[model samples]
Target: MSGDHSTYAPRSGFTKWIDTRLPLPRLMHDSFVSYPVPRNLNYAYTFGGILSIMLGLQMLTGIVLAMHYVASTDQAFTSVEFIMRDVNYGWLLRYLHANGASFFFLAVYLHIARGLYYGSYKAPRELLWILGVVILFLMMGTAFMGYVLPWGQMSFWGATVITGFFSAFPAVGDWIQRLLIGGFAVGQPTLNRFYSLHYLLPFMIAGVVILHIWALHVTGQTNPTGVDIRKKTDTIPFTPYATIKDALGMSVFFLVFAYFVFYMPNYLGHADNYIEANSLKTPAEIVPEWYFLPFYAMLRAITFNLGPINSKLGGVLTMFASILVLFVVPWLDTSKVRSAVYRPVYKVCFWLFIVDCLLLGWCGSQPPQGAIVLTAQLGTLYYFGFFLIIMPLLGLVEKPRRLPNSITEAVLSRRQTSAGRPAGATAAPEDRG
Candidate 1:
């Protein structure tokens, strides 16, 4: 959506008047239809569009769920049950909203991974990347608060446990905890506060999403080659080419999302949540949703103090830092080469980092004792190390493969190789550089 040149032409008198006064239709045509994108972009780019759709779906379903939801602790659980049992297609709506959050996070994670692989955070797109990370933080907060709306066993204690992390601060910790739960404990106030915020934060996320899109359009999109768009030949209009690919990708993604919604609605949720909240009886073990597992593992990983800081504070800092670090990734990485495909060592470490995150997620789900604790600790180390150490050091030392002269060259070379032809078999065009 970066190209500002508009080719929109209103055909009718009323349309021409509207175009002159408002230009709304012209804006759409220019932004979505006529905008230019890299020809080399792949399916990974579709996650952005998918995320937009999921956000709207969540807002729509959440509004309906909220209309019938009771914020009171006594009725919150029952209200959810009522929706599922008596309301018109409430079960479908509930399942869709629940499953939609999981799918939303899934798409975002893949989107972030693609960015890391192709170095979308580098250079002119740094603000675009930062805005994305901000959206992610908003999503996490929104999801966590929304998770607590049901007032189920997990919802109640999950709120209690997660909010309690704020109390790890040395001086203001207790105050922050009180502020979050609206009191010393997770009770009526906590539910009301979380409910109100859960309702409002999605719209806030939407605002940031608008800014995110603006930033994306401003910087344009990055491709797999990490090369800047240099000529018209290296790009295509957004209407038919990128739109078709995005549609196919979204179709496949929605198919999987539908399967989860229809058949295994509760597959991703915990059984303990089906039971109503009982403060008197705590579950044997507390585990958050899958998306939070890796960070949860990191939070529990710190079992020892670092001099003045105790283990509890240390863990809290580490967990928050894990997310905050992402904001500064633009500077943390020292690589001149944008894409991991060009850097052998970075490519290997990138995959290993993914494995480490999965391992941490597994560790987070298990009881943190014996080997799980140790594994979580190691995973935590690597999680930070990948960003703090490897990213900075490897970029300086690693030798990357030679990049093609331009995006067009890379695309043509790949096509030729795949067709049993040698690289550079295609006719060479004038290099923009």
Candidate 2:
């Protein structure tokens, strides 16, 4: 599939000259126009395109907002208010930038979920999956910094709380914390540092995104069937086929984004954030954004020390390990089978894992007391166990359903079954599940 890029041809003399000089048009034609993707790819595959669009939208809005934004701690909150009330369409830009971050995370979570469901992290794509995790880490850092730019109550406290986590490390912890905040605490220097990094990280993300896409095109996309393409019939040209689906998916996604932007701009934001930062008077409970909730829950889950490890350090390690675990996921699952579709046992476990994540998110938002703390501990256990225990064990003990020989057969056999024909009749007995 990676070798199939010879179909592009310049139509005119001027175009031909440019093609010989740079060949960027040829590269685009090969990558997007004629690239062959699985014929049976569902809407789940569209999130990649949606993410690209969201990234572009975020950068554009951010650049505009930065023009009016004040990085100073004293004027940061006032500058945001100025953008919302005084500048032309500044409110729209702010809403788009703010809400766009949420939707961007939503799309990325779904994209990662889809990857897990379809085994997009399997062998020959391990680097692709690792690069994706790298992108997620970069996004998290970018979002955390961006969250501080508002310089609201939550923004100030959130930065202080999160950055303080680094102090859990032995000897070097305090230094790391100081380096992150640019001083002893979350004050003027911290605000300046975060604002500059927040502005710069998105472009860094864009660069990594290029490498991610390059890796993806090199390995090709995984389909729902978990079967590789073996014939021309297994795939279709990307232009009209995949492009139309991506466009439709993005259209629906944009409508939801627009709704949040226009009608419920503050729905996803904290009311306390509307108030300016007050170091003297702290909010009752400082919560990070919703996207950070699950990890926050994990961070809080470690209430007790394990031998020499203190609670603070344990929680910090656990929180960091949760994300780091994903970097090794391509090697964690022992199964040769890609898709959960065939692995009924893993399929059940997968949904349970997702529930555990949502449970953790809920736990993070609430006061960490009584049942919530206990539940979060249990959820965190299951979260790691799903990767550390279940994934490795299930692959050896469970029996997966029969898989079709190739993508073409899977598509044809599904259609045949929907038409009331016996599944076994469409394929040889050995290939029938």
Candidate 3:
């Protein structure tokens, strides 16, 4: 599970002494500095850096915006408006933070898709992938809490509907709901706690992300071939090499983000958010934000009530279990080959998973009746089947392509035969820095 290179921990006193001036410039001399990387990393790998940038942007804008806004459920919506109208730069900050969320999800989905496509979640970096999942779940919870702060109709009702789902458990579900809400309903207290957590959880995610990278450094990144790059020639120092590549990737990603911010800031947003919350008159349809739709749809798919258990509790467990199923993926997929490219059966099934996700997203936005319900149920079934049946089956049936003798051989082969580039094509020019 460990990478070939030992980590660069701080050395002893004399080493630390000379380190400050001469520095462990050797640190940069390692993988990233002049490190050669996969010349064909593709767009998916760009996401980790893109997500990091977006998290920073959201944090900065959010802190400034928070200064103008009140957290009280009563004053929350109005204070937001005050910031929009009265506070300088409030509109800019709000839009950036909100749109940053949409972009964050966009990048994360692509990142995850890339992992699926390239088999980035295989044995060597499985923990990094799991850490990414942890970050993703926290992002969701953070986004949910932030969404409620606007105190708009969708925000208020979304909280009510989502929190109310907890009561679907058997005997103790109702009590859990009460504990979550501090009462039978989602109201002022729920708003306060959610807001507090919303503000706090990003830091927690950052801490985990640090661990994620620590894990990444330990195992190194898995490429499309899932080959371990062990030879010294296979890696470049992480500084200039990874730094430049990451920068280029980030720049390309920001262009997409900029277009969203400048041309259509509200394109991804629901129009209902403009309306103030009305506790008495509910909106006919109460869909959550697009990012939450797939799982939201999953929660609504269970219609048959369990004996003495509410359908809502059924939905709640189904919701959590949907993600819980993912935690078992490493074990669930028993394929010897890591990359789906070499595993034809797994490749097709992985695409099926993508299709199911898209279908679930569509179902989430529509009424939970008739065709929508049927579609959700089917999609939900396939979602589980991909993990439970398809992945495990493919491991037994699929014959993998011959693997390269080493990671360097694999990278070299692709460079020469496929890309028409030299073996060390990704290496920097002399003045690259």
Candidate 4:
């Protein structure tokens, strides 16, 4: 699916001259306009484009908020208040930026789940998947730092608690923690550094997004049928089909984002974050944002220590391993089939994994005690076990149903069935060929 290298014919003298110097327009035309997309692709494919729009929205709103935000520990909380009351439309900008982070993560999770279902990470698309994981890591870092910029009770204590994770390291633990916060605790230095990094990392994510799209163009897209394009009829030009679909997806996504920003701006945020920072007072229960909850639950689930390793270090390792496990997922599933649509057993396990994640998230939001702790422990076990044992074993044991011969065939069959004809009915000579 590597791009066709055919030169673009300039339509005018201006474009001809520009093309001679730099062919950026031609590159765009080839990459997005004339690119071939599988005709059988479903709505799940739109999340990638929606994620791109969300990234742009986040950067725009973040820049505006940064203009009014103060990073100093002394003025940070008061400055946020000032922006809400004094700066023009500042509340709107702040809400958009805050809620945008949640929406961004929501879209990314959907995108990842879609990829897993369709096997988008297999074979030629491995680099594309790796780039996406890198983007996710960068987004997590950027969001963590941005949360600290508000200097609210949750922001300050959250920073301290998260940075303290580095202390789980052996001899260098203290030094690592100090390096992260710039002192023994979260203070002016920590705020300034987080602000700087929060501002810088989005552009880095944008740079990686370019590589991800390039990789996508090289491998093309995996369709619902999980079959490679074998003929011209199997695909449609990206311009009219995919571009229009992406535009519609973006519109729907913004409607949901606007609902959160306008109706319940603080719905996704913790109540504790509304209060100014007080080092002497810790919140009754410390919790990260909803997006980080599953991993947070994993971190707190470990209560016992192995020889020379305490529970704190074990929990930290367990949390990090949950994400790192995804890096090797392409190699773990040994099935020749791509889409889970034909793999009955894998589909059931996939939904179970999703439920386990949701359960872990709920456990993370609660205090680590009683039945919740036990539930989280079990959820965390399934989380790791699904990736490590279930995926590999299922691939070898599950028998996938026969796949459609091609994307065109799949689409034709669906159309025929919708028209009340049997899927196996005779097709036109051209379609059959």
C-alpha TM-score for every candidate: 0.96, 0.96, 0.88, 0.96
Q: lDDT per residue, candidate 2, 344-405, as tens digits? A: 99999999999999999999999999999999999999999999999888989989999999
Better of 1 and 3 by lDDT: 1
Off by over 4 Å in 2: 1-3, 421-433
Task: Give model 1's clash tally.
Answer: 0
Cα displacement (Å) at residue 223, model 3? 0.4
RMSD of each: 4.5, 4.0, 6.3, 4.1
For candidate 4, what is the lDDT?
A: 0.90
Which numbered prediction scores highest in lDDT against the true structure? 2
Taken over the whole model, the C-alpha lDDT of each candidate is 0.93, 0.93, 0.80, 0.90
- Predicted structure 1: lDDT: 0.93
Rank order (by TM-score, best first): 2, 1, 4, 3
Name the 10 consecutive residues with the lowest summed lDDT in model 2.
1-10
* Backbone N/Cα/C clashes per model: 0, 0, 15, 0
Question: Candidate 4's residue-wise lDDT over 144-215, tens digit each?
Answer: 999988889999889989999999989999999999899988899899999999999999999999999998
lDDT of 3 by residue, 1-433 (tens): 1224535444687766766677554454443444445533545666788888888988899889878888887888899889878888787788888999998998889888888777777787778888888998899999998999998999989988887877766678789878876777778888888888999999999999888877776676767777667677665555555677778989987888888887898898888888888788798899999998999899999887878656777778888988887677777787888887688778888888999999999999999988999899999999989889887887888898887766677777766786644534665776344
Compute the lDDT of residue 368 as modeled in candidate 3. 95
Candidate 2's displacement at residue 260, Å, is 0.9
Rank all candidate structures by their lDDT, best first, as comma-separated numbers: 2, 1, 4, 3
